[model samples]
Target chain A: MRFLSKALVITWKDALSEMRTKEVLSSVVVFALLVIVIFNFAFGASQEKMLLVAPGILWVTFTFAGMLSINRAFIPEKEQGCLEGLMVCPISREAIYIGKMLGSLLFMLIVEAIALPIFTFLFNLPVLSLQLVVVTVLATLGFVAVGTLFSALAVNTKAREMVLPILFLPIVVPLIISAVKASELALSRESWATLASWLGIMGAFDVIFLVVSFLVFAFVIEE
Target chain B: MGKSYLRNILSAVSFLLMAASLYMVFVYVPTEATMGIVQRIFYLMVPVAWLSLLSFLIVFIGSILYLRKKQSRWDVLARSSAEIGIIFTTLTLITGSLWARPVWGVWWTWEPRLTATLVLWFIYLAYFLARSLAAEEHRGATFAAVVGILGFVDVPIIGLATTLWRGIHPGALIFQGGLAPSMLLTLMVSLAAFTALYSLLLLQRISMKNDEIEIKRLLGLTAERHNTGDR
Candidate 1:
């Protein structure tokens, strides 16, 4: 309980700071919206054809925006040397990992929450469904679960920006594939039975990576 | 002395077995009826694929030991294994592609195993990039060890996801039926030969890395002594 609360405090601190600066959220939202517009022009498919590509475009937007948001998870601390301060705090390394992960997860979810409605409105697709939301959260959870760890790892490297996606994207290929499949089924209003396996994959990915990231993050963030 | 002897024996064994396997593949084993001449690449490809996977497992184990013991030797082992692993993985992908061109009618397909191998290739590249770009030596090793661990863990998940995604296609069985005894024997020989080659390369790389570290240490010592002399 105490650990959860402390982690929440870190998340709350991140939220408060973002709310103050309004940097990541605004940029991520605009970036996501622009991707939707550009992909629309790039594909230039008809309405029926649009449905076929929309799920991919949607996930790509989320992924890119999520990367943008998660990339900031550690860079600011690194630049400002707040990482040492965080490490010196009265918390386990695992708590710090959870805290950063939740912060990124929360930031990404908020971006998606804003982006998804705008996406549906622009494409004139009825993609606003509970199932889609569930898939989005599950997929996003897995994304940031691994992303936060890599974000920390990348922040320490010489090519900080270049390293994250290289290290991150391949690892999350399963999540992205599962998310795209699940979203396709969700958009098409498929039954739960059809969607279960993808959800399972996303769930398995989330669980496996979440535990692994939590364990390995200590090695990454150690000074 | 003992290590050099082991290396010499390994190289010799690898040379002899490779020669024998090459002969068996070219002359002894009957041409696979379906793949014909191109099937010969299979002898080289399968062993490399197996070695590639083995290399990462070695990396994974070495990384865990490095973290646990904090010994530079473990890190050296992991680094050498990863370097060798990347080469083997590249060979696997290239050979797989060459085999696929004639058999599958295209140089590439989104087939599950192919997709998995490609992703593994990407992961190996990422591991090397992470290592090479870290500014400090020990830090680079630690960062790479983390990558090594994460990359290995993610392989199965990537494989499963690609398999499920490609569930639309009937998975191609590598061989339609069990291998003939003669072909199996050839495969065993090739696998052994490749394993020997992989170990030989790993041993050579580890020694080279140890030498590099020793040189660096000596350089740092000389610089420190020069500074003291100036003071």
Candidate 2:
């Protein structure tokens, strides 16, 4: 219960800050929208003929948008030099990590939520099914699990902007593959049986990453 | 045996084993009937790929040990192993491509195993880049260690997903055949030789890292002395 509250407090603090500033969320949402628009231009006429590639494009947008948010996940703490202050808090470092990760996850999911409707309307793909939503959540969960950790790790590096994506994209390949496949099945309106394996893969990846990331969060948060 | 003597023996044995493996690869292993001599590349590629995973396992173990012990040596071991592992992985991809070009008739295809190997390569490449670019001291090492452990954990999952994706996507090439005993024997020997070589490379790299650290320490000491003397 203490751990839960500590993590929630951190999450609540981030939520309040974002509500006020709206810095990271606005930029990520815009970037994600831009990616969709660009993809439409590049593959507009062809997409109608072959909607199969739509899932790939959707995921590409989400991954890039998620990257943008993660890049700034630590900017507020970094600029204010408040991570050190957070470290000094009575709560465990794992709590701090959970807070930051949840904050990033929520921020990314909001962008994803906004992008989803636009994506479906623009691409005219059937992506609003329950299975797709679950896949999206699982995929994004695994994504931010590592993304939050890497962002904190990258924020301390020299070339942070470059380092974060390099560190992030490779580790999230499982999520990308599973998410894209599951989305493809859902978009095509395939039966649940066909999407089952992909869902299983995403679930396994998310659980493993979340647990592992939580365990090692202290190492990154500490000096 | 003394430490230097043991290292020397290890190095010599590693070289001899590699030579024997090469000879067997060229002379003993008959040309595969279907793919002809180009299939010979599989001997080298398979073992190198196996050892690459072994090297990654080393990095994973070393990273965990460093986190537990907070020792510089463990960090050195992990860093060196990651560097060498990436090299072997690169070789694996290239050789796999070489074989694929003739056998599968394409230089590259999104085959699941190859795709997984490619992703593994990217993860480790990112590992080295992150380490070098990170802040000095435990800041970088600790973060890289965390990434290392997480990345290792990610590999099998990614491999499975991609393998399953291939099933959904459907590709033209599918082969399930038994290997001859002679080929299997050669593969085992090649794997052993590659393991020996990996050990030698890791030891040498770690020693070099130690020397580099000593040099850095001495330089810092001199700079400190100069500052004190001027005061």
Candidate 3:
């Protein structure tokens, strides 16, 4: 109970801080929206063609925006030197890892929540479905799970911004592939059975990485 | 024999095996019934592919050992193996590309094995990049070990995911099947030669890393002595 509460508190702390400044949220949203617009212009994709390409565009934007947010995930703590203070606290390191992951996931979800409607409105695609939403949530959870871990790893590196993306993207290729596939099936209104395989992959990836990241976080964050 | 002598002998043996395989691939092995001499590139590509995967597996082991023991020697081993893995992986991709150009009729294709190798290449390149870019010197090994472990775990996932994605709409068509006895023999010899070569490169690189560390240690000691003497 103590561990759980402490993690929740840490998560709450992150959320409250973000709510106050809204720095990560605003930039992520703007960047995501810009990606959607650019993909629109770059591909010259029409509505009919958009459905075919929407899943790829959607994931690319989400991933890029997610990477952006993660690149800064530890910045405030790092800059203010509160990271050491937090490490010295009574809480277990695992709680800090979970808390940061939750905070990051929450921020990303907020960005996606805003971006999805706008993406739909512009592309005129039927992206606002229950299945699509489910797939999006599952995929984003897996992404943020790994992304948070890498962010911690990257922040302690010489060239943090460069370190994160190259290290991050290759590792999460599986997740992206699964997300794109599931999103494609959901958008096409395919049978639930077809989407189930992809969802299963996402679920398995989430479970494995959430546990792996948590276990490894204690090691990676040690000063 | 001394370690140096053994290493030199191993190096010599590797070269011999490689030269012998080259001759076997070119002359001893019969041309395939379908594709002619271009098929001989298979000998080069397959062995390199095998050795590269093995090299990465060595890195994974070395990394886990480093994390467990915190031994700088393990770190050296892991980094050197990664260096060798990248070299072999590059060879694998280039050879695969050459074979694909002639056989598959395209300069590039997203075949499962080919794409998976490309992803593995990126993962290890990232591994090297992460090693160099780690914020602190000692922390570099630990961070890289974590990535090394994760990157190896990712190999199967990538293989699975790429297969899944390609299942919906197929691309990058190519054929792989049974081989003749002579061809298999040539492949065996070539793989043995590449394995020997990997061993040679790994030993050389590891010793180089050790030497570099030794030099750094001596420099640090001399600087400390200068400071103490000045006081």
TM-score of chain B, candidates 1 onward in order: 0.92, 0.91, 0.92
lDDT at residue B198 of model 1 (Cα atoms): 95
Tens-place lDDT per residue, model 3, B81-145, is 99999998998999999999989899889977789899999999888887788877778888888
Candidate 1, CAPRI quality class derived from DockQ: high
- Order of the predicted models by DockQ, top scorer first: 2, 1, 3
How much is the lDDT of residue B40 in candidate 3? 92
Report the lDDT tens digits of candidate 1 across residue range B136-209: 87778888888889889988788778888977433443454689999999999999999999999999999999
Predictions' DockQ, in order: 0.81, 0.85, 0.77
* DockQ: the better of candidates 2 and 3: 2
Ranked by lDDT, top first: 1, 3, 2
Clash pairs, candidate 3, are: none
Distance from true position, residue A217, model 2, in Å?
A: 0.6
Candidate order by TM-score, highest to lowest? 1, 2, 3
Per-residue lDDT for A22-71 in model 2, tens only? 87788788888898888878775665553877888899999888888777
Best model per TM-score = 1
